[model samples]
Target: MTSPLPFLVVQTALYNRLKNDATLSSLATGVYDFVPETALYPYIHIGEAIDTPDNSHDRYGGQTVATLHVWDQYKGFKRVLQIGSRVQALLDHQPLTITGLTHIVTRYEFGQPLTDPEPPGDIRHLVLRYRIVTEQTP
Candidate 1:
């Protein structure tokens, strides 16, 4: 079976970085394996992660795909966009030290923003996906 340690490591790394960030800290932030119920706008939810085996004949590794959700109840996308930009700056192409894994690289895969009314409410959703490559350490 595949180990979840890499995913957990990536999640922890992102949470550690963003939680301390001046911008994101002001808003409602959640770094978890599942979304939580809360009454907070301009929220940052770091949820959902998947890992796929990316190994070769002489190496063991995996490519992790993770999603970051930026949500706002505000009428415009400006706030979400700004926050998203900050997130990108903090994480995109940045090197991360993940426990139990030797990090290779972390970069943005893509980001899609939209007007979402899911959960039966009006909100702006900016979803960013990232790819983190890693190999087993020791």
Candidate 2:
């Protein structure tokens, strides 16, 4: 009866490194420890079943959509642009992991309109879209 947004849990340390390094060129360049087996959390949702007859009862199944949000330390220049490009490339090749998932960059945007002036420092906002299959653990 409840629907939750799909999410990926990455190490805070790894995230911090990526956040701090203003010049990180690629995800491959960052050092991240492999996630533990118990850390995988797959989301679930209820929707219409694909193969059940319309007149039959209990014709509903579960669906899941996984996504992740990566916030990088703002590098007050072209760092946003650079990081976005690198992430896009990774998604195109499905290189984020070795199994059970496919990732694609569905959208990318920048700039803040609500705040009068952006904060000072090397920081940037990044939004990444990905699709994951939960049949196998990654």
Candidate 3:
């Protein structure tokens, strides 16, 4: 049997978790893989992912490192930081329901804050990352 794509599964699970959370829904406009050009000021965007194999003699496993971006047009980092904290609280060392795979653990890797230096420099960006480890069933 062919093993499932760990990165895609992990990403989907993460998206579902964030999208359905009432707290996140109230904080951000929406969770999106592709953000609309006219999307509102605050939103969560599922960004890049990296998958690496972690196979054993008897089981197939993988590690997926994913990045989530929080964008806001607030005056300072307060808004974005609050949202990022919620994201971390939701996923850090938490359990994820990955389809067709056994979830080992999902750990928060790091968070970075950035500024969009374009014309109006009021845009705030927070980059959050997580590492998800999964293994296939026997």
Candidate 4:
């Protein structure tokens, strides 16, 4: 089975790029922008999962659930960015929906730390969870 960590990394990178890319911002009409660390402190929870068949008949399968946490100073902006049209493009046309969002799952703040001792400012962090369906072949 393929590791979900790699997919998570790729997904996170894509989100960061989309949030920072000027062209996407222009096209999306500034729907996304730099987010702050504090705003994301509450943290947003995203859920995803995948199912894979175990038998040759393809009747039975196992499911894998993915969870994500997002943090940004601009909570509203970050949420909007996550559900923006750009995500559809990033998925290469795959259907991904922002089903729901829960703030402050835990008391942990996720994001890149600042070079100085001071806390990272305006840094948005997100944790996303997803499920993927895989077909088993004999």
Best TM-score among the predictions, by candidate number = 3
Q: Alpha-carbon error at 10 in model 4, in Å? A: 10
TM-score of each: 0.85, 0.34, 0.95, 0.31
Model 4's C-alpha root-mean-square deviation from the true structure amounts to: 11.5
Cα lDDT for residue 92, candidate 4: 34
Sort by TM-score, top down from the best: 3, 1, 2, 4
- Please give, for residues 31-111, the per-residue lDDT of candidate 4 as tens digits: 223434433233333434333333334333333343444444553354434533343344332433221211111111122
User: Number of clashes in every candidate structure?
Assistant: 0, 5, 0, 26
Candidate 2 similarity to native, TM-score: 0.34
Error of 1 at 50 (Å): 2.0
Error of 3 at 38 (Å): 2.4
In the range 1-138, model 2's lDDT, one tens digit per residue, is 222222332122124434344444333233233433442211111111112111213322222332333334434424544554655443332423322222222222222212113555333434443332222222
Error of 2 at 30 (Å): 4.0
Q: Kindly give the stretch of ten consecutive residues in candidate 1 with the minimal lDDT sum.
A: 26-35
The TM-score, computed over Cα atoms with residue i paired to residue i, of candidate 3 is 0.95
Q: Which model, 2 or 4, shows the larger TM-score?
A: 2
- Model 3: clashing residue pairs? none
What ranking of all candidate models by lDDT puts the best one first? 3, 1, 4, 2
lDDT of 4: 0.36
Best by lDDT: 3
